[model samples]
Target: MVARKSAFSSEYSWFKGNLHSHSTRSDGKLDPPQVVELYRSNGWDFIAFTEHEFYSYWQELSSDDFLVLPGIEMGLDIPKFGRCHHLLGIHKSGNGAKHLVKAPPAEKDGMAGAQEEIYRLGKEGYLTIYCHPLWSRVEWEDISELRGFTAIEIYNHSSEMENHSGLHLDHWDSFLRRGIKVWGVATDDSHHWMEDYCGGWIMVNAPQLTVADLTEALVAGRFYSSTGPTITDFGLDGDEVYIECSPAKAIHIVTYEPWGRSFYAEPGKSISSAVHRVRGNEIFVRAEVVDSNGKTAWTNPIFLDKKA
Candidate 1:
């Protein structure tokens, strides 16, 4: 018998997905068919239709064969002179029962408003992850306050273009230093069905290929992030955190601690890296793999829950 590909093999351990996208229901230029075709053709296991204010209105799919997630992007702005734009809501599992709770507005217009909406989503039994927290005017309190954020994107592929500058890693370093326990997701955040738009993605480890399974894993932080590379695994012990990577060149193990700072363990070229001296009462650790071709991958934080 020919050597058959093992779906559960470590080499093919993750399910590739896009967490943010738009469709004809919102301002995105592509219809469902074209958008679905683009992602499916690119080998993505799943893609969410997070339109500006409404779910993709998925009734558009001629067949439910594709792993399409129903999600809505709730955009709210900060107070006077505060340009911070926030996104609330969830990439609802289209296969599940309807989620009827609408997030309430924290304020008429401001971060407070966005907060209320997120809380509402939570009340309705959905976990909301803050999208592009540093996008344009989006700002927040210290990394320590990140306690409730379901998760935040350390890197958003679509918004990475910082004006005329290059790659925008944003304030991800700050969150790490604070020992914030959150998953880092890399999403295409695509709107136009363009190839360059799907530059970001997350590799999720799920028992099976399905929206429900993937969504549950993501909410549990059982995944990693990347623009192009891929992370194998990450974990933390007493005062040390360990990680494993793929096609690994140089590995970076980053830990975020209290007193608002971060530390790094760069082990030149090893598939595994560990941080020995953890700081303060808490330490959130993650790992990165820089592929030989310059591409890179990231694993979600393996949190060290030390309460003081």
Candidate 2:
């Protein structure tokens, strides 16, 4: 059987969205309505209002064309490092209607606290996304054993702009290399609403653009993350793993360490597709496309040992 977890399909439409953001409900520069207007007017299909420790369902801001997902970000302290763990909890259409009633009390037990909060969020019917490991100063060792996160932020636009610690592919590969089946995401943890609002986003393939459809797609890894590049298709058929993207400077088929391959375009030119013949022994496979400007798009890994 072919093992592939591809989000692309002719039947589904792609929607651009940012899963993490803030507003004046927390410390964001814009109010909730302004944040909604900012993304809506900018061509985004959806935005999640993940204000810190404050949960609100901005259903009033949503229209037939734009969606506002109910979301909140919980912070747990790592007293040892004086930093905090940021977990984004996003609810489906009807979920998380109540305010901050079910959120767990802030804990300071380092890794254990983070794990507990993740478990709590899942139990509360929210999909948890571990946010910005590099900005949190979390090492692979700190989160290798943590479980129940639907995805981790491989790139956070705000973290990259403010702290220069946005990309966390090393942490993502650590989870995948160990056979952990978590997905990766790129988000603009946008608080400032200026340059941070549109730096990173995801393209989700879903049947429709409702909160339920988008939430389900995100939970099933039916999406890919991007800073600028676009991944048109990615999947595996038998031993042939393939990916098609926009004109790119380089395309990489990422697999188990020491086993993957990279294809680069010739000087003054660009390539748009690449294929890798799987050895039938690699743990998993994913794709990355890099544009001439060094912007990248990433696909979620497909575990070869599992059937499609």
Candidate 3:
């Protein structure tokens, strides 16, 4: 495990960026600079250079308008099991740990290996996340039962395409059913920054645009996942709540009200209007939209009146 590295903070700003990527550092072709430049040139406010199973987070930026967080994928090296390779989201750039996979101890080994490594990072204050639990059809029944990372990605654009992994809705739904309050993220899983890439993203509503701001927003779950549709405003009032989307083909108000009443507003779930209505004892409410290509937009969950 690595120690806390030095890095710049986003200062409570909305730094739109990606959480997963591959470069020549691992199996991907692009270099760090080329990867950074591609996203920066394309209006991406931030990016995490998750090269491989090694922790190589970069800090120093070319200017204030852009910032890059150094990171790496973690887990095991068992490519055959498809249970290897999990993502660790590092906020601090250059805190070099260099230890990719901590070898299993012939003696004191069990779940201690993963628990120690993960907990050690958490103890040090890094914002870690579990990326694409199903990248290899890996199950989340265990990870969902544990508490280590702060967030999870319901959709990893790139992996979903190459691996043909399901949309991850099943896993996300599982977490919800268990009362797990972990935040949900939708990432481009971008490696190409150019071309037909760059649709999976999170729209975070914050007062500023910086890494610190974005990180805080993320930890607080103040964001929405989207493939294309961007939700502007969504919330509830008393027995009546509302949602506003950006030119939606259809708006579905998915409400997990009362923290356990799993209900969604879509073609077969609730009502359709490109807008929604909530007048009941629901604890949470949100909006979603789908295009003809089956792309979806997930709005941040909103709190509704518990007594409603």
Q: Rate the local accuracy (lDDT) of all candidates.
A: 0.60, 0.86, 0.58
Candidate 3: tens digits of C-alpha lDDT, residues 1-308: 23321112233334567766766667666777787787788777777766554655555543577766656655643334445436465553234533333322222122333445566666555677767767745565345445666677778887776665626766665565455656678776666633424667776655565556666777767777887765555554334445555554456656664332223344544332343445555555656676545678876555444332
Q: How does model 2 fare in lDDT?
A: 0.86
Worst 10 residues of 2 by lDDT: 94-103
Q: TM-scores, in order shown?
A: 0.77, 0.94, 0.76
Q: lDDT score, residue 52, model 2?
A: 79
Candidate 1 — which residues are off by over 4 angstroms? 1-13, 57-65, 80-82, 91-107, 142-147, 161-180, 193-195, 236-240, 257-282
Output the number of the lDDT-best candidate.
Answer: 2
Local error of candidate 1 at residue 171 (angstroms):
4.3
* Ranked by TM-score, top first: 2, 1, 3
TM-score for predicted model 3 compared with the true structure: 0.76
lDDT order of candidates, top first: 2, 1, 3
Q: Provide the lDDT at 87 for model 2.
A: 92
Give one digit per residue, the lDDT tens place, for model 1 in 75-181: 77655464655453454454442422333334555555666666666655455666776554454452224345566666666666433122334456566555555
